[model samples]
Target chain A: MQLDVSHISIQYQDNVVVDDVSFQLAPASLAAIVGPNGAGKSSLLKGILGIHPLKKGNVYFNGQTLSSVRPHIAYVPQRESVDWDFPATVLDVVLMGRYPHLNWWKRYRSIDFNIARKSLEQVNLIDLADRQIAQLSGGQQQRVFLARALAQEASIYFMDEPFAGVDAATEKNIVSVLKELQAGGKSIMVVHHDLQTIRSYFSSILLLNKKVIAFGPTDEVFTPERIQQTYQRESLLL
Target chain B: MVESLWADANARTVIVCTLLLNSAAALIGCFTYLQKKSLTGDAVSHSILPGIAIAFLFSGVKDLWVILPGAFLTGGLSLLSIEYILRHSKLKQDTAIALVLSVFFAVGVVLLSYIQHHGNGNQSGLDSFLLGKAAALLSADIPLYFSVAFVVVFSVLLFYRPFMLISFDRSFALSIGIAAHRWQQVMVVLSVLAIVIGIQAVGVVLMSAMLITPAVAARYWSHRLPVVLLLAVLFNMIASVMGIIISYKYPSMPTGPWIVVCISSIAVLSFFIGNAKGILRRSSLTVQK
Candidate 1:
C-alpha cells in the first residue's frame, strides 16, 4: 500500500504547530520521523492517522481515505500516553487489537485469542500473558504495545516513540519487529529521537521542523547539513 | 427482629429499592472511576437540585416521574457546561466541576427556600430529598426504580466492550472505528441517569459516595475489569443490606446516611486487608522479600 500525506497543517489556537507538511512512502518501507522538540513530529503523525484534527490536509492509504482502510491500519501510541495502572492482563490488552474485526454482537473468537497469543510470543511476553499490565517493567510495557499492534495484523503501522524509554535489548527487539513487518510487505512509520542509529534502523527519514525540511531515503536525506537545519543548531557532532 | 423486618411490606420495599439503586450506582461507578471522572457524579448530583425544585414549582406536585426528567435535563446540562467551560476558558476541570456544582446547588437552595415560604401545602416533604428518606419510598415508586435500574444495567451489558475500551484508551478505541465520541456521550447520559434515580434514595449530598466508595474498595481486590465490576456490586449490595437492617432495628435512623456509613467502613477495611494491592498485603510481601 502507498501512504500519502498532502499539505497537512495543524495549529493550536494561535500557534502553528505543524505547517503544510507533505510526504509519501512506498509499500514495505521502514521510515523514521526525526525532529527537535516541539517540531510537531508526533502531531504530524497523529494528523495523518486522523487521531488529531488537521488544520488542513488529506491522508490517503492505497488511494483511499483512512476510514475505508482503518481495519488494515495499526497504531502504537507513546508508552506514557496510557494509564499503566489500568486493570487488564497482558493478553486482555492484546485482544483489544482484534476489536475492529468484531461487531457489537460478536465476541472474541478462538482465532482472535490465538492471534493475540501469537503476537505475545513474537514480543517474548507469552510467559506473562495473564499478568496484570501494572506489573510489567518499562520495556515490557512497550513490548506489550508492540504486541498489540502485531495482533492487529495491519498492513501499515504508526508508532509514536516506541523506543523512547526502553533498554538496549528492547530496542533491538523493536528494530527486529520493524524489519519483520517490512519483510512481510507492511509499511511502518515511527517517531524516533536517536540520530546515531537512524542509518542502521530506517530505510527513510523525514526530517521536520514545523514543516518538511527534508524527506527521502536515509542515505540521501540524513545529511549533517539537513540535521543541523532541522534542529537549528551549529557545530553538532553525530 | 430480622424475621419481622422481612415480613413487613414497607421494609421489603425499601430493601429491594435500595438494593437496585446501589447496584446500578456501583456498576456505573466503575466506568467513572476508570475515566477519572469520579467527581462528575458529585457535580451532577448536586446540580440536579435546582431541577427538582423547578419541576415541583411548575407541576404543583412532588411526583418522582415529573421531577426526574427535569433533574436529568439539568444534570446533563451541568456536564455540558463543564465541557464548555473547559473548551472556552483557561480554567481546569476540577475548577469547572466546583464552579458548576456550587452555582447550580445554590440556585436549587434558593428555589427550595422560595417554594417553602410562598408555595402551597404540597411542598411539605420536599426537603427529604436533601438528606434522603429511603424508608419513605412507597410501593408506588418501585416501578420507576425498576425501570431506571433496567435501563442502567441493560445499557451497560450492551455497550460493555466500547465503554471499557473508551475508558482505558479512547484514542485507540477511535482508531479501531469505535465511535468514541458517541460512546462517550452514552457514558455521560448513563451517569446522569444513574445519579437522577439515586438522588431520591441516597440524596444529592451522599449520592456520589454510593457511586465511588464501592468502586474504590473493589479496585484493591482485582486487576481485571470484569472482576472489579462484580466485586463493586457485591460490596455495595452488602453495605445496603447491612444499612437496611440497622435502620430497621433503630426506627429513628435514616437509611441513606447509614448506607453511606457502612460502605465507607467497608472501604476502610478493604484499604487495609484487600487481596493484592491493599496496604497489609503489600507490607507482608515486602517483609517476605
Candidate 2:
C-alpha cells in the first residue's frame, strides 16, 4: 500500500500552522518527519491520520481516501497525551485496538484475546498482561502502545513521538520492531525529533518547518543545508 | 425506636426504593467521577430545581411523569449551556458550572416560594424536594423508581464498552470512527435521567454527594472500572439501607442527609483501609522503607 499526503494545510483558529505540505511513502519503508520545535511535525502526522480537518488537500491510502480504508490504517498517539492512571490492564488496552474489526455488540472471543496476547508477546510484556497500565515503567508503557498498534493489524502505521522519552534499550527495541514490520511489508511513518538517529533508523525523511522543506530518500534529503533550512539554525550541522 | 421502625410494613417499600435510587446514582457516578466531572453533578442537580418548580407550577401537580421530564430538560439545558460557555467564551468550566448552577437554583427557589405562597393545595408538599423525605415515598412511586433503575443498569451494561472507550481516550475513540460526540450526548442524557430520578429521594443539595462518594470509595478498592462500578453499587446499597433505618428511627431526620452521612463514612473508611490502595497500606509501606 502507498501512503500519499498531498498539499495538506492545517490551521487552528486564525493561525495557519502547517502550510501546504506533501509527501508519499511506498510500502515496506521506514520514514521520519523531523524538524525543530514548533515545526508542525506532529500536526502533519495528525493531518495525515485525519485526526483534524485539513485546511486544504487530501490524504490517499492505496488510491482511496483515508475514511474508505480506515481499518487498514493505525495511529499511535503521543505517550504524553494519554492519562497514565487510566483504570485498564495491559491486555485491556491492547484489546481496544480490535474494537473496530468486531461487531459493536459482540464480546471479545478467544481469537481476539489470543491476538492481543501475541502482540504483547512481541513486545516482551506478555507476563504483564494483567498489570494495571499505571504500574508499568515509561518504556513499558510505550511498548504497550506498540503492542496495541500491532494488534490493530494495520498495513500503514502513523506514530507520533513514540521515542520521545523512552530509555536507550526501548529505543533499540522499537527500531528493531520497525525493521521487522518493514520486513513484513508494513509502511511506517514516525514523527521523530532526534536528529542523531535519522541516518541510521529511517530510509526516507520529511523535513518540515510549517511546510515541506524537503522529502525523499535519507541520503538525498537529509543534507545539512536542508536541516539548516528546516531548523533555521546554521550551526545545527556542526 | 428501632423496634417501631422494624414493625412498620411501609418501611420495606421505602428501603427498597431508596436502595434502587442510590444504586442508579452510584453506577453512573463512577464515570462522572473518573472523568473529573464531579462538579457537573452538582451543577446539574442545582439547575434541576427550577425545572421541578416550573413543572409543578404549570401542571398543578407533583406527579413523577410531569415533574421528571421538566427537570431532565432543564438539567440537560444547563449542561449544554456549560458546554457552550466552555467552547465559545473565556470562562473556565468551573466558573460556567458555578454560574449556571447558582442562577438556575435561585430561579427555582423563587418559583418554589411563589407556588408555596399562592398556588393550589397540591403545591403544599413541594418543599420536601428541597431536602428529600424518603419516608413520604408512596407505593405508586415504587414502580417508577424500579423502571428508572432498570434503564440505568441496562444501559450501563449494554453500552459499557463504548462508554469506557470514549471516557478513557476520546481522540483514540474518534480515530476509530466512533461517534464520540453522539455517545457523549447519550451519556449526558442518561446522567440527566439519573439526576432526575435521584432528586426526589436525595434532594438537590446532597445529591451530588450521592453521585460521587460511592464511586470515590470504590476507586480505592480496585484499579479496574467494572470492579469499581460493582463496589460502588454495593456501597450504595449498604449506605441506603443504613440511612433508611436511621431516618426511620429518628422521625425528625431527613433520609437524604442521613444517606449522605452514611456514604461519607463508608468513603472515609475506604480511603483509610481499602485493600487495593489505602492510606493505611501506603503509610505502612512508607514506614517499612
Candidate 3:
C-alpha cells in the first residue's frame, strides 16, 4: 500500500500550524514525524489522520482519499491524554478497539473477546488483563494502549508519542512490537521527539516546523540543521 | 373512609409518574457517569428553573408539555455555555465547570424567587417543583415522562458504540471516522431529556444526584461498561423503591429528600461495604499487605 499527502495546510484559530506539507510512504514502511514543540509535527499527523481539518490539502491512502479510508486506519492517542483512573479494566479498554467493527446495540462477542485476548498476549499484558487501568505503571499503561491499538487490526497505524515517558525496557518492547507489525506488511506513522533515535528507528522522516522542512529517508533528514530548525521555532507544543 | 383515601386514583397516578421519572434518571445517569459529565448534570439542572419560569408565562395552564421544553432548552444551553467557556478560555475544565455552575444556578434562584413572591393564585405549583412533591403529580403527567425516558434510553442503545468511542478520545475517534460533533450532540440531547423527565418527580436542585449516585455506586461492583450499567440500574431501582416506601409511611413527607437520602445512603454503603472496589476492601487488603 502506498500513501501520499499533497499540499496539506492546517490552521488553528487563524494561526497556521502546518504549512503546505507533503510526503509519501509505501507498504510496510516506518515513518517518523520530527519537529520542534510548536512546529506542528503532531498537527500534521492529526491532519493526515483526519482529526485536524486541513486549510488546504488532500491525503491519498492507496490512491483513495484518506477521508474515504476510514476502516483501514487505527489510532493511538497520546499517553499524557486520557484519565487512566476511569473505571475500566485492561480488558475493557482493549475491547473498546473492536467498537468500530461492531453494531451499536451489540456488545462484544466471542470473536471480539478472542481478538482482544490475543492482542493482550502480544503486548505481554495477558497477566494484567483483569487489572484496573489505574493500577498499571506508566510503561504498562503504554503497553495497554498498545494492546488496544493492536486489537483494532488496521493496516495503517498512527501513533502519537508512543515512547514518551516510558522506561527503557518498555521502550524496547514497544519498538519490537512496531517492528513486528512492519514485518507483517502494516505501515506506521509515529510522531516522535527524541532526536537521538530517529536515524536508528525510522526508515523515512518528515521533519517539520510549521512547514515541511524536509522529507526523505532518515539518513538524509536527520541532519543537525533540520533538527535545530524544527525545535528552535517554538518552546511549547500547545 | 381513611383507608379508602389510600386507594384513590391520584395516589396511583403519583406512583406511576414517580416510577417513570426514576427510570429515566437511571438511564441518563449511565451515560453521564461513563463520560464523567456527571457534574454537568448538576449545572444544567440548576440552570433550568428560570427557563421554566419563562415557559410558564406563555403556558396558561401549567403542564409537562410547557415546562419540559423549557427545561430541555435551558439545560442544553447551560451545557453549551459551559463548553464554550472551557473551550475559549485559559481556564481549566474543572474551574470552568465551577464557574458556569454557580453563575447559572444563581440566576435560576433569582428567577424562581421572583416568580414565587409575585405570582398569583395557588396555580404556582412551581415552588413544589423546587423540591419535588410526588404527591402533586397528576394523571396527565405519566405518558409524557415515560415517552421521554423511552426515547433517551433507546437513543443510548442505538448509538452506544459510536458515542463510547468519541467519549474516550475525540481526536482519535475523529481520525477513525466517528464525527465528534454528532456524537457530542447525541449526548447533550439525551442529557437534556433526562433532566427534563426528572424535573416533575425529583426537583431540579437534586436531580443530578439522582443521575450520578447509581453510577457511582455501581463502579464499586463492576469493572466493565455493560456490567456497570446493569448494576447502576439495579441500585437505582432499589433506591427508588426504598424512597417510595418511606414516603408512603409518612404522607406529608416529600419524595425528593427521601429519594436523595436513599441515594446518599446507597452511596455511603458502596463507599464502605462494597465488594470489590470499596474502601473497606481496599483498606483491609492494604493492612494484609
**Who wins the lDDT comparison?**
1
lDDT for model 1 comes to 0.88
Q: Which model is ahead, 1 or 3, in terms of DockQ? A: 1
Index of the highest-TM-score prediction: 1
- Name the better of 2 and 3 by DockQ: 3
RMSD of 2: 2.8
Worst lDDT 10-window in candidate 2 chain A: A229-238
Q: What is the C-alpha lDDT profile of model 2 across B1-289, one tens digit per residue?
A: 6466657778877777788888888888888887789999999998899999999988898988888888988898898889898989999888999999999999999999999899778886687778887887767777987898779878878888888988887767777778888988877777778878888777887888888999999988887889999999999888888877877778788788888998999999999998766788655432100
Candidate 3 wrong stretches, greater than 4 Å: A107-109, A234-238, B1-13, B84-124, B283-289
- RMSD of every prediction: 2.3, 2.8, 3.3
Worst 10-residue stretch by lDDT in candidate 3 chain B? Answer: B280-289
Q: Comparing only chain A of model 1 with the true chain A, what is the TM-score? A: 0.97
Per-model lDDT: 0.88, 0.85, 0.79
Check candidate 1 and list the clashing pairs: none
Model 2 interface RMSD over true interface Cα atoms: 4.5
DockQ comparisons of all candidates to the true complex = 0.52, 0.44, 0.50
lDDT, candidate 3, B194-261, per-residue tens = 87777766788888888899888887876666677677777776776666666667867767778889
Using alpha carbons, what is the TM-score of model 2? 0.94
Q: What CAPRI-style quality would you assign to candidate 3? A: medium
